[model samples]
Target: MSVHELAVTESVIAAISMQLPDSQVAVVHLEIGRLSGVMPDAVRFCFELAGEGTCVEGARLDITEPEGTGSCASCGTSFPARDALAVCPCGSADVTISGGAELTIKAVEVTDDV
Candidate 1:
């Protein structure tokens, strides 16, 4: 088993446990950046294994990929930047990343059995 995905998935479980210690989670929503270097499928698989016997056990992991964005310092312009190291639209390499490269827990669904 790869440690990378397991580590991240464990973190997610820990975070959820902190807030909803009593409730059982049914779904886990995560926002994955296109340039975040994390594979959605791999994370999902790890989540299944890591969540065993926990509140997130058998919970579905919903991963959403947001579009990458950046801004040009020279031209004061903004555009989509799927690649973080991509150049600016004004023929300049001076581009600042505005979005993407994110791995966040968006939301969680739990039954109101409490």
Candidate 2:
């Protein structure tokens, strides 16, 4: 998983670098929810490895995991969800997961070489 995360981070660096040509990445902010099935620490560690020899090298990785919430359509009850297969306490499979499934790059800070 860390290996995959490294690859993903590398790709993100490439994409973001294109947007800020001749600049150095200072920080990378991300939102990794509980249901996203990713470990923030692992991702952060891998990010450092993946960023080697790239503009993202030495950049800080800020990760945030938002709380998970879901609703059971069968009972119209909303509850906390740690994963997608959150079974409602009322014994219902008609569950709708909300939040906690995000794996997004919120922001990227870069410094122009100038």
Which candidate should be chosen as best, given lDDT against the real structure? 1
Global lDDT of each candidate = 0.88, 0.82
Q: What are the models' TM-scores?
A: 0.92, 0.85
- Residue-by-residue lDDT tens digits, candidate 2, 1-114: 577677766777777768766678898899889887777777877887778878788889888999888999999999999778899989898999988988888998886653
Query: Whose TM-score is greatest here?
Result: 1
Per-residue CA lDDT of model 1 for 1-114, tens digit only, reads 568777888998999999999988988999989888777888988988889988988788899999888899899989899797978878888998888889999999998764
In candidate 1, position 109 carries an lDDT of 99
| Candidate 1: clashing residue pairs, number | 0
Each model's total of backbone clashes: 0, 0
Instruction: Report the lDDT of model 2 for residue 114.
Output: 33
